[model samples]
Structure formats: structure tokens, C-alpha cells
Target chain A: MKFHWFHLMSYPDLPDDFREKNRSVWVDVDPNLYDPEVGHHAYNEYLDELEYAGQMGFDGICVNEHHQNAYGLMPSPNLMAATLARRTTEPKIVVMGNSVALYNPPTRIAEEFAMLDCLSGGRLVAGFPVGTPMDTIFSYGEPPATLREKYREGVELILRAWQEPEPFAFNGKYTQLRYVNPWPRPLQKPHPPVWIPGGGASVETWRWCGEHNFLYAYLSYFGYEAAVKSMDAYWETMAEMNIDQNPYRAGFLQFVGVADTDAEAEKLYAEPALYFYNRCLHWYPGFTSAAGYMSVESMRKGIKSQVAQAGSALSSIGQVTSTETSWKEIVDKSYVICGSPDTVVERLEDLATRLNVGHLMLLLQFGNMGKELTMQNTHRFATEVMPKLRDKFGDHVDHWWPSSGLANEKTAQPAPINSELGGNSQPTPD
Target chain B: MEELNLPSGRSAKVFTFGDNTAVGDNIKGDNARQDNDNYNDSDNCNDNNLPLVFFHSAGGVDENDPFLNQLAASFKIYAPVAPGFSDLEELDDLVSVSDVALHYDDILEALNIAEFHLAGHSFGGMFAAEYAAHYPKKVKTLSLIAPVGLWNDDYPVLDIFATPPLELGQYLFGDPDSELAQAFSSLASDISGNEEEIVESIIQTVQGLVTAGKYMMPIPDRGLNRRLYRVIAPTLLIWGERDQIVSANYAKDFAKLLRDSKELIVKGGGHMITLEFTDKLVEAITKHAK
Candidate 1:
């Protein structure tokens, strides 16, 4: 399995009563709670943690975009990817990524992704996600009724801009372009690998991803057991489409916290885990499944919710919003796999095998987690947890991975972790 | 259930209530020869044959609506459910008010109705105004009850979808505890024993809002301010004085744009002025249309 160290960079200082007292952590979230001084210290520390993951030999370092949300600080993830490209080496600069629909022209995404690929020497995985309702409908003011269409058109334009050799004139219902020419074509031939990170509830998304051969990365907050229903839906869709059961065609994100022993890991992560489950996921009730957010086709299949709760991550099976879930409930459900290396390895292997998850995006840095703890967690997972699961999916070829090291003999074999790239600086908390 | 095959290659179900037509008959199917006309005659409407194409609000329309039942006694009531309101289909075709106006035209033409009195309430009020703006000459008279095609930064249209379902009655009814409002609230309780029916009702209610949201969510204005001058039909704009959904102040906005229009503000009424003051509303519509 391929390991990508993902950071949500949740703002650290929401009050304990944030869930009860505040309107939301997302759109219309009270801005006064955010302290730029704290953010300055936090951002640098966060970037340093990612670079540490890079030097620790993670297959990828990931960042994503969210707007006007205290849940995630990065409004523009490309800026973060650019910084990672210059600061780190070896790891694929995976941006899980720009919300394609929000851009006016959407060619901006093509230009920026291309720039990242060239700058990172072709080690970039371009992720196209239709952003959450909070980000797209509420914050960006895109009409919920037409947001999906806008997203589809935006992705098409970006793809054509990258793949089409000549500058072409394009006219669409949402977007009309006179000359679609992006300068400085990407270093990766035919463009970088396109991974569609989705909620996996929308049938249209499943069919679209399956037909396009794009990796449908299911980012569920509710862990693997809760994920069974959604991930199974994707695999079922693939079967219906008569495609191969290659695990490489899909990716899954899970929040993971690791330490020396199971009890110790629980104790260490409990506070941050509570903060994340309670604060960062505190979506206002009505906007979670905003009106018309799910397409008619998905609703017809009796999918009562929108895109597998990636954005609307309301607990359907559990029914309790994450805010009400205790640390014990959190772990029992594997919301975050808090345990020693052996415990994490066993559960992860079971999950990855059951769900056929070849690409694992582990959220190591979460809400209110101090940089010291995040670095320690990243260190433990990389040194202990990842190696055990590496060969589990070795039989399946990852066609969705970036074609970087294939062309260059120098980059073919990645170098081991070294202090030069900012590894081993922090003393292991254990 | 007067199913119409629209010229746009779309088929629709319309509830026709009046003098000549039977309620819920297959108007254009194999039974067409057996029944030359099958509009619903639920109220035993007087044989005036003066049709009133009644448009409903985001709350949805029913064949048995007391207000429509009253109006049917005076004119043939053709109540067509908006495309996606309950059926949850053709939603994309009803994205904008202009699209909605054209869709209504096709529905009317398919039913072979012309130069009829047009009236609507709330979201339907907005739709009626839009259709009137499109084909001014086709409408003999128009009545809009709490229409929502105009927006004021000061008195904004209340977002029904944004408000929690439990607290919605305060914005919609003049008195939440009134007999009619109580009956409407307890309508859900009428099916409390059947969980499956309750779930279906919730789904349909939400579906109605989602469909209505296409034209009304975020903001209800759809360029009707620039185009209301095209409506030449004599018009009546009504509002509850205490309406929280669309304030009575909007009546002035609509009146200013309409060359031949008047306004009515019912005392102590909210957005659902039609349901709250049905007798007053029916009398006003009949007098104005006459």
C-alpha cells in the first residue's frame, strides 16, 4: 500500500463549547476566534511536519483546499503544494486538491497543477474534488442546484487545457473560452495522475470515476466499518461497469494516531481526537445535506444523503454527529485508529484488504494537535506502521500513480531518510 | 390527473377542477374517446367555463385545497404541479424563472387553454407573475399572493429551506396556534402510526423545497424587476401585513412595475394569507378578476 501523510491543519483554538455555542466551523463561522499570531506559529510548524514526513519516506505528502472554515486553514492548497515542492523531495506533492468548480475560468487549475508538476520534477498527483457545500454553496455562493454541472464543466475544461496540444476555442453552458492555451506544459507526459477524491455516495460520481479510470478516493470521517457501505458501493459500481477489481483504482483517507502502546496511544491522542471530532466537524445542521446537493439519480437509488458524507459527514449508521461522540466511541468505531504499531497494522491490513484500498491517505495532523505530537505521530507511523502494509497491495499495479520516477534514472530509487531533509530533529516522544 | 403531452416532448400531470372535466381522468390516453373533456369537477364549478390557471407555492398544491375549492366555484381551476415539486423530475429544466415561465406556457398550450385568468401564491405567486410577464396578452387577469420575484436588501426574502422545519410555521402563518395552522401542523400526526408513510411525507416535503430552491434559494429575485413592465394584464398583489417570508413592503415593488395593478394587505396575516384568510382572499380574487 502507498502511504500519503495528510494534514487537515484544523485551527487549534475553538472553545470547548464551540459545537453548542457556535453556528458552525465552516461557512459563517465566527472569524474573531482565529488568531493570526497562533496561525503564523501553526502554519510553519505544520509545513515542517509535512517536510519531516517527506524525509521519513512517505510515498506522498498531501494538502487540500477549504474556504472560510476553521476546520481547515488552507483556502488555497496549491500555495501549500508549491512550498512543499521547494522545501521537500522524494514524496509526491499530492494536493487532494483544488475545488475545481469555484474558479471562474478553471484554466487557473490547469496552469497551477502544471506548474507544480514541473517544479516538483513530475512528482505531483492532481486531485479534482467538488468541494463541500460549506465551501462551494455557502462560502463561494455557487447555486446548489447547478454546482455539480459547474464542477463537471470545470474538470472537463481543465483536462482539455492540459491534454489538447493546440490552443482550442471552447464554449460551454457555464464557461466559454476563446483560447484555451496554458503555457509551460507539465513535466509528466499526458499530465500528472488524476485522482478524484469523492464521498462515493453519488452514483454519478461513481460512474464518472469508473468510466474515466480515475481513482475514486473515499474520504470518510467515520472509519472503515462505517465506510463498508460507501466503499462497497464503489466496488459494486465497478462490478456493474465490468471493470477490474484493481485496488489501485481507489484511495481511502482515515485519521490515524500512533504510539508505543495501545493504552499510551489512546491517552496521548484523546484530547486532540476529542477536539477534532467535536470542533472541526461541527457543521450547522441544515447545511450538512443542503437542498438539491445530491443528484436525482443518486436519490433514486435511495441514497438518502449527499456524496457519502465527505462534505456532509453526518453519521448515518451512528446517527450521532461527531461532536457528541466520546473518545471511546471514536476509537471503538475506528474513527481514529489509536493504538500501538501492532494494533494499527492489524486493523489497517484488515480494512485495506476488505475495502481493496491500495492508496492510503493517513491524516496524521488533526485538530488542536500540537506540532510536537503530530511530528511524533508521523514519525511512528512512517517507521513502524507503513512498512508492515507496504507489500500487501504489491500484486496490483497502481496505474493512477504519477509517472515521475519511471523516466528519470536518478529519481528511480528514492534515498533513505536523512537529517539533511529535516528528519530526526525531534527526539522521539516515546 | 390531466396528463398533458407538452410540445417540448415532456409529459406532465395537471389537476383540473371545473364545470366540464372529471377529477383525475386520463385526458389524452385511450379513454379520450370515452370522455371528450376530463378536467376535475370537484367543486361542481358554475358553468361559466372561465378558466383560472391556479399556480401554487413552494408549499405545494392539492386538488382539495380549500382556497382552490372556493375559486373553482367561480372558474375552472387548472392546478399543475411544478415540474420537480413532488415528482422530483425535470428539475434541471426549471432552473430559472424564465425556464419555468416557458414550461408553464407549454403546459397550458398542451391542455388547449387560452386567454385564462392566471393566479398564484408565494413561490407560485412568483411563477404566475413570470408567466404573465412572458405572455401578457394571454392572461385576462392575474392575482399574486405573497409573490417573491422582487428582493430588497432591507426586507429580504426569508429562506424557508434554511429555517428548521419545526420553526417554519411562525414565518408562514399569522398565528401559529390558530385552528387552521394547528390542523396543518397535526397533518403530520394523522400518519404518525405508519413510519413508512411519515418517511415518504418527509421526503416529498423536502423534495418540494429542493425543487422550489432552484428559483428561490440564496435570493428569490430572477430579473423580474427589469421585466415586470411587460405584464399588461390587470393584476392584484396580496400580502399578509405581518408576513415574515416576503414582507408586505414587496407589494409596493410589484405595484410600481405593473401598470395596471393594485395591492391588498390583510390584517394580522403572515405568508400563508391564502390559507389564513381564505374567505377574504377568494372574495378579493373574484372581485378583481371580474
Candidate 2:
């Protein structure tokens, strides 16, 4: 029943004085008035918001890693997480985390994650991802075929670094480690719980989560209906493997918004979501191409798109990124959830009950949405939808996540919110 | 990255294709690999053969038979299955011609066949044109047969009735009732040959298409002019004199756009001329490959 909110803090008009024109060499930016000073200011403002959310009764706060992209400014979410860890208390600090394969020596991830855990008193949810081809190949120079293997080895090394009591030697095809010892063991014994964010129904990912009993979050950008379908696909595999159907073990993510009325929320939220996907997701050429023939079944059933049969044509040049399929289109397909508190609550409860899932990850900051609107949506949901769900669940499953018995046991309580009516309910920075 | 679920419920992330043979590589399967692998390399040759990767057009049929193969006798060939149409793992994330083109870059890198000659048919030609445009250095020479990306507004309109099942059989093979003609007409002209071979191949391919119907769809009109002019590779433009799908008039249009290129006209032959008239087609390919 514990609710974790993940924010990407997509900014449209960052304060002019704080923008950095040459902050990142890898990605293109607006040349005029792009000041490094402005970038840091905006970064502080974003962190302040996440901290506020933690205080506003959210169980956990999440940040992610992306490089050379304005869709999200955090090329290194670990930096942001470390900052939050120092500032916040109680709430689990989940770094939706690093793209393990993107780093040359993924030990960098282990070190940064360990630092954040020590700084935050051991609240961390470590997430490992095989970055999108655009990020992995174009930005990081990691080849696609080697991506799965790289992620695999990086996970092995980081986990061992946390749990292995003695120094050890490790060797692998892509990564080799001789010292094999990491400092600042996590606050959670053995390690913090592992959360794997899957773009879609990655069968190997589901199996891995099911086998290890790690929390599997289907990190989605499409919408809710697709999320359910994807989760169902994962559940089917989980069932085949006879993995427990406990709610906390499985999680789904959505771009959520709540307002006085469904229409108001939809109108306010639609444009930003569209902008994030259509413009910010663009990749420089030579990223997605594959040499071998991927089976048709994989495309339709697993890869999940109508463009699958176009073969490599879908990834070819002269192809403009398609316009965002509308909110109505998404609702019909269950891609998003934007409505009044009652409507949102009903939808969420139904979705969770239908899928029989335990954990739900809510992405409140999307695309270039402003902080004002994002805060409004978060406050309303926290005040309305969350309390009901929190009270509804019985003792059958642990309502509070990051419980002490968990391997990565971090504090489950969120930062305390302002209780004096609606007057000044802002969260204090950690 | 999640680990794989083992049958025993313990997680393991290891899965491999492990040299598994494709089911359709038989007579019915089109065996696209064999089409690229079957070269007329009868003359004295070294192991260091020039690789010819054939890009199938929209129909997903291999066009490197007879003609492309006869030319392949002088070099190596590697024809790839159109993504999602072969025995390999399917890609669900791709859509639009640009995405396909980018993904092809991944394929080439994965195979470690750095530099090679690329030739595509129809829509495949559009993909090849995109590849040449993006990775001109990787391309040794480009050959496009009835390429579809270049548009000629004045081209003749498609008459669906003229090539319905019965009429298409009569138009291609002089036998409306012949299953071989029907099979060949359903595929491209070049692939239609002996009764047994054509029918079997068509049956399996059509089934694959039907099964993949959920994922297959027409390409949208994405902006191409911004890129078509940037291809700098030496190119060969092969088109049917009477091409209807992309129009014969576009031949000069494409030729004009390509800075370093040549054109070959398959007189009276259709878009699938590489298979229909193999000898003359082989001559054109040899002239360029040399």
C-alpha cells in the first residue's frame, strides 16, 4: 500500500539566469541565454520539489539517470539522489537509477550508490536498466548486442560489492574487477532492496525479478492500458514460474494527474506529456538499426508496436517522430490516468485489484510540465487517493514498504507534511 | 536489468538462439539466407569475397535469385531477413522508415561485417537509400531496384483490377489457372518459377504475412527530401521500364539526386526484373560491382 512518487522534473522555461549553454558537451542545447548558473538554480528548485513531495506523505521519492537530453536534466541521478539523501530523512530514496551498461566501469554506480546510502542513513532502492539503444549506443558507445551482457555483469559486480564480506577477484567478458571491495556498506544489511525498471515486458527481467523476489516496476511512457497489458504479460510469466502473486513484488508506473474536475486535469496534463514524448525523445541517427532478422512474433507479441513489420524501415531516415497519440487515444488504450481525485482513485484501485499487484509507482513530473501544476496534482492525490488506499489494505501484505525485514531495509515513513489546513503545506528540505 | 525466470522458479537470464535452424528455411520458407548465400562463384576466387547484402522490398521476398546470384558468383552476398519477417527475435519498438534505417545500423554493427555492398528492392530500396544517406562510408556501392522513395507526381495510377489473382496470373505466366503463376504473381515476377517451388514458397510466406498481420501496416508519408539529397555513395539505379508501384519516371529523378551513381533500365521487364530476367540483371550488377 506504500506509494512512491517518481519525478523527472522536465522544465520548459528554466530561470533565464540559471541556464547553462555548455553544461553538457554531448547534447545540444539552446545556445542563447543557456547559463550554467541557471542550470544549478533549476536543479535546486527541482530537488526542493521532490523533497516537498517526500514531506507531503509520499513513502518514497524517485529520480532517474539520462544523458544529453532535456527530457530530463539528470544525466547523473546519483548526484541528485546524494543531495536528497543528505537533505531528507525517513522516506526511502530510490534512484530509479543508473543505466548500468552505459558506464565503462560500472563500479562507478556501486560507489555513488553506496555514498548516497551512507549519506541518507541507508534508504536506497537500486534500479538497474539496459539503457535505450539511443542512450547506450549513440551517447555511451556501448554496442546493442553486448548491452544485455554488460548489464548482467554490472549487476553481479555491484551486488557482490555490497554483500561479499571479504575482498574478491571478478572477471567477465566486458568488465573485470580485481579488488572487488566497496566501502560504506548500505544501511540495509546485505544491501538495499533491488528495483528493476523494465520499459516493457522484458521476459528475462520478469524471470529475474520473480526468481530473486525483487520488486519489478514496469516503467511505462505509453499509458495505463498498455501498462496493464504489459503487466499481465509479466504476470503470465510469473504464474508459469509459480512466483508469488504478492502485491509489493510487482509494480506498475503511470503519468498521473488529479484536479477538481476530470476535464481540467486532462487539459492541463495533455500538452506536457505530448511534448516530452514527441520532441524530447528524438535520437540522432544510427541508433536503432539491427543487422539480424528479429522474428515477427517478437515484434508484435513482445516488442509491442504496429511498426514492427516495416522491418528496419521504422528506424530509417526521413521518418519524423510520429505525433503523440491523443489523451483520448491513451485512455481508450489505458495509457494515462488524468481525472478528479475520485475518478483517479477508482481507476487506480481497479487497476491494482485487477492486476493483483502490490506496488504502484506514480510519475508526477512528465515532459516539460511546470512545477506549479505538478505540485497541484501531487498534493491533491496525496490528500485524497493515497489515504484511502493506505487504510483499505489489511495485514495480509505489509502495507509499509522498506520494512525492516526486507534485505534493503530503509525507513518506510515519508517526511512529515504541513498539517495546518491547506495553509503553507510545503515540505521542508532534508 | 531483470534476470530470466527458470522453469524451476529460480531466476536465470541466459537464453541463446544456439545455432537453431529456421523452420522455414525449407523450400516453402523462402530461405532468404540461402538466396544471399547462393552465389554463382564458379570462377577462381579467394576466401576474401565481397559481401552483397540484399534488402528485400515491401513484399519481403528475396530478389537476389538468378540475376543477383549470377553476379554474386563474383562476390560474397549476405541478404538479411526484413526485421520481424524472419526467424530472429522480433522488434516491437520500430515504426516509420527512419526507425528501420537506424536499426539497420545496429544489425550491421552486430554482425561485424563493417564494409559491404548494399542493394535493396522497392521499399527495401528506400531503406537502402536511407542507409546510404546515413552511413555512406559503410556502403561500397548501392543498387536500388525500382526504389520507391523518389516520387514522380506524373506516374501512372495503380489499377488494382488489372492484377487481381486471376488477371495477375495471366499477366505474368500466361495461365490464369496455374497455381505456379498465381504464386509467382502473388510474390514478385522473378520469384515465380517451377510450379512446385513457387507454390510452396508462396504458401509459407503468405502464412507468415497473415500471422504477422497485426504488426504490418502501410508506411506513412514521412519527410524524405531533407535526407535524399545527402547520399554520397556511388549508386546504381535499376528499375523496370514499366514499373507501376514507384513509377519508371522516378528513375531519372533518383539518378539526378544521387551525385555519384549510374542507372540501368530492364527493358520490358517489371519491378522484379532481378528474378525475371536474371542474365541481363546479372550483367548490370557485375558492371557496378567491378
Candidate 3:
């Protein structure tokens, strides 16, 4: 299986009382709280984490789009991808990606993405997300009724701009461009592989990905245990549509932290995990779904949270927004895989085998995890865990990964420390 | 009351009442034609009562509106449901208030109505204003109650869609604890104990907010402020003194732009004045239309 290292770059150091006092951490989250000095350090440090992941030999590294939110510091993920492009060579530069409808011309994305692809020597996995309601309808102020249509139009415009042999005059409802041509086109043939990371609610998005032969990356803070039914439903959908169950056709994002022992790992990762679930994901209920954001047909299929007929919701499968949830509760709900490498490997393999997804996007850094711990997790997982799961679906061809810059590179780096050498001992926190 | 088939695959649900049908002269439903082949000036003057083109509130077209029922006693009421409120797909054909104005014009033309008095409340008020501005001469008089279009920095509009369902009464009614307000609050949990009906009512309530949000969200101003100068009708700007959604002070914002306009603040009333103060609304509309 191909592993992509990802980071949300959630702003660290939110006051402990932030959740208690605020209605949300997004949209209208207090700007006064965002210290520019901290951001300067964060941008550099976050890029360092992506760079570190690349040097450690992960197949890919990712960044995504979110606006006016403290959790995701990337408003323009392409910039981060560009910096990664200049700084790293081996890893596929994944910007998963810009919110298409939010852009006025949207061709801006085509230009920027092509620049990244050219810089990375055709190592780009372009992602087109419909975007969260908070980013699209509420923040960008696109009418919810027309957001999907506008996105569909924007994607078509962008694809055509990249691949169309000559300049073409395009007249779209939301966007109109007389001359549709982008300079410095992508080095990848036709365009980069498209991956759609979604919240796993909209049936239309699922269908769109299947019909278009694009990789649908189902991203949820609630981990694989919560995703069993939905992933099964996705495969069910693929089967019903007469599409092949080529595991690489989909992706799953999971949070991971690793240490020597399961108990030690739990102690190290608990604070950040709690902060993530409590502060980073704290959102106002009102901002969840804008009006007409989901079509009537989708609503009948039980839109976003409702699609989980887990039957009265015994656990917090979909009720993630309810705050004050404890770290133990989050772990109990299988929201994170924070344990020793053995435990993580066991659970992840189970997840892959059960969910039938080959592309595993591992979110190594989440919430307010400091550089030291994030590096520790990154090092431990890369050296210990990834090798075991590297070849789970190794034989399958990843049709969605851009093929230009990805051969003759060994993705697995087994740690050099010998078994008898005490494994380059570092002092433990007694 | 019947369905009026309009152009662009639109099926407009129109409620007509009172014996004195002014336009199309009492003709109903599919039999009506928009071609204007049998047009007459007498349609506007039926027993000295001008045809009342009533635009219902953002809550969607209710044939049994208390305010409309009272107004029907003295005038013919042509109440048509706005697009999107019924079928969400209809919103695709509308991007701005200008599109809605043209769509409403089609509805009236389909009913074979040439001239009438226009009145709208809440979201409907915003559309009524836009429609009047688009075709100024067709409307004899205009009435807008708690309309949302202008933004007042000091008294900014609140996010109605964000307000929790049960607590919505506080934003809508002057006396949230009153009988009618209580009924609206308990609409989802009515004593009838019919699950389907209760669920349907709850869905309808959300649909109202969603449809209204299409034009009203992220500030309601869809260039209606720029075109308010075009309306030539004698207009009345109505508001509830205690209206929490849009304050009574907003009446000045509309009245100042209207060519010949008057303002009225109903005592102890709120945003849904037609529901809470039906008599006051009926009396004010009756005196203003003729």
C-alpha cells in the first residue's frame, strides 16, 4: 500500500478555556488569538515536518485547504505544496487541493497546480474538493443551492484549461473566460491524478468519484472502526455500479502516533489528541451544513451525519461536534491509533483488509502536537510501522498516482540500528 | 386554489379567494392563459375593490394564512407560493432578487392579471419591492412588512438560520410565550402524535429557512437598494415595534427610497405581524390598498 504523510498544522497554544468560552474554532474564531509570531514559526516547522517525512521515504506528503480556521493553517495549500516541491524531491507533492467554487476564475488553480507539477517534475496528485460549508457557503459566500453546480463547472473549466490543446473560449454559468489558456502547463501527461478527499456523506460525491475514475479519499477524525460500514457501503456502491473493486480506487486518512510501548505512546499522544478532538474540531452546529448544500436526493439518502444508520448511534460515530469529549472516550471510540508499532500495524492492517482501500493517507501530525513529539512519532512510525504495511496491497497498480517521477525509488527504509545495539537509546521520561 | 403551469417547467401553486375575481374574471387553474388574448381594463375595478396580489411570507405559501383570510372579506386575494420554498430545484433558475422579480411577473401574467395592489411580509416583502421596481406601473400600491434587503451597521441583521429551532420564537415574536407563538414553537411536537405529519412539519419549517436563505444569507442586499428609485407606486413600509429580526427603524431605510411612502410601527408586534397581530395588519392593508 502507498502511504502519504499528512499534517493538519492545527494552531498550537489555544487557551485551555477556548472551548468552554467559544461557540466555534472556525469561521468566526477569534483572530486576536492567532499570533503572527507563532504562525511564522508554525509555517517553517510544519514545512519541516513534510520535508522530514519525504527524507524518511514515505511515498507522498499532503496539504489541504481550509479558510479562517485555527485547525488548518493552510488557506492556500498550493503555497505549502510549492515550498515542499522546492525542498523535497522523492515524495509526491499532494495538494488535496483548493476549493474550486471559492475561486472566481478557478483557472488560477490550474496555473498554480501546473507550476507545482512542473517544479516537482510531474510529481503532483491534484485534488478537487467541493469544500466544507464553512469554507464555501459561509466563508466564501457562495449560495448553497448553486455550490455543487458551480464546483462542477469550475472543475470542467480547470481540466479543460490544463488539457485542451489550444486556447478555447469557455462560457460557464458561474465562470466565463473568453480565452482559456494557461502557461507553464503541468509536466504530467493530460494532467495530474485527481483525488477527492471528502467528509463521506454526500452520495453524489461518491458517485462522481466512481464514475470519473478518480480516487475518493474518505477523511474523518473518527477512525477506521467508525468507518467500517461507510467504506463497506462505498465498495457496495462500486459493486452496484459495475465498477472494479481495485482497492487503489479509494483512500482513507487515519491519525497515528507511535512509541516503544503502547502505554508510553498513549501518554505521549494524549494531550494533542484531546486538544484535536476538543479544540481543533470544535465547530458551531449552525455552520455544519448550509441550506441546499445537500440535494434533496442526498437528503433522502440521509445526508452527511444521517447516512450512518448505525441504529440510534451507540457510539460517537457521527456526533463528533459535541464538545468536552475526553481523550479516553476518543480512544475508546477508535478515533486515533496511538499505541506501539505492533498495535498500530495490527489495527491498520485490519482496517485496510476490512475497508479494502489501498491508498493510506497517514496523518502523522494533528492538533497542537509540538515539533519534538511530532518528529518522535514520525521517526518511530517510519522506522518501525510502515515497513510491515508497505506491501499489503503492493501488487496492485495505483492508476490514480502520477506516474512520471515515481520509479526506481525504494519507499521502505528499515532502521539501521542493529538488534543487539540497544537501538540508539534516547533518555526516557521517567 | 389550484396549480398554475408556467414557462420553464414551473408549476406555481396559487390560492385565489373572494367572489370578486378581478383578473381572468373568476377563471381558475389550467384554463388560465398568459397570452393576454381576453384582456380588459375592467378586471382592475371589480365592485370598486382593486385586485390584491398578496405575496406570502418566507414561511412559504399558506392558503389558510390568518391575515389573508381576513383581507379576503373585502378584496380578492391572489396568493402565489414563491419558487424554491416548494421545490428547491427552482432555486437553480434564480441567482438574484432580479431573477425572482421576473419569475413573479410570469406568475401574475399566467394568472392573466394586469394591475393590482401588492403586499409582502418578511422575505416576500423583499421580493414585492423588487417586483414593483421592475414593473412599476402595474402595481397600484405597495406594502412591505419587515422586509430584509438593507444592512444597518448599528442594528445589524441576525443570522436567522443559525438560531436554534426551539429558541426561534425569541427572534420572531414580540411575545414569544403567547398562544400563537407557542403553536408555532410546538409545531413539530403537536399533540396529534402523528409521526409522519410531525416530521413533515419540521421539514417544512427547515425548508422555509433554507429557501429564504438563498437570497437573504450573508446580507440580503441583492442590489434592491440601487433599484428602489425605479418603483413609482404609493408604498407603505410596515414593521412591528418589537420586531427582533429586522427592527422597526429599518422602515426608514425603505421609506426614504420609495417615491411616495408612509411608515407604520404596530404596537407590541414582532416580525410575523400577520400571525401575531392579524387584525392590525388586515386593517392597515385594507385602508392602504384602496
Q: Point to the candidate with the largest DockQ.
A: 3
For each candidate, how many residue pairs have backbone atoms clashing (under 3 Å)? 3, 57, 0
The native-contact fractions of the candidates, in order shown, are 0.25, 0.00, 0.19
Q: Give the per-residue lDDT digits (tens) of candidate 1, residues B1-290.
A: 67777877667778877564432232222233233354334353222344788888877877788888887777668999888866656765565788888999999877766557899998899989999999887787899999998999989888665555545665678887888677765563243344455445555665777777778767788889998999999999889999988999999989999989998999999888888899999999988875
Residues A198-287 of candidate 3 have per-residue lDDT tens digits of: 887777888888888889999888889889888888888888899999899989999988877767867888888889988988888667
Measured with C-alpha atoms, the lDDT of residue A422 in candidate 2 is 45
What are the runs in model 2 whose C-alpha is more than 4 Å off?
Answer: A14-38, A266-274, A281-297, A303-321, A325-335, A396-430, B1-68, B72-290
At residue B205, give the lDDT of candidate 2: 46
| Local distance difference test values of all predictions, in order | 0.81, 0.61, 0.81
Output the number of the TM-score-best candidate: 3
Better of 1 and 2 by TM-score: 1
Model 1, range A1-430, lDDT digits (tens) per residue?
8999998888988998898888678888898999999899888998999999999999999999999989899999999999899888689999999898899889999999998888888889999999887788678777667788889899889888988979999898778989999987788878888899987678899889888888889998889998888888889989999999999898899989988877797788998988998888887765565656776556545423421332221221111233477998889999998888898999999889889889999989888988889888989898898889889878888898887634643442234457476665776687
lDDT of 2 by residue, A107-171 (tens): 78777787777677767888887765445644564434345656878888888888888998888
When 2 and 3 are scored with lDDT, the better candidate is: 3
Sort all candidates by DockQ, best to worst: 3, 1, 2
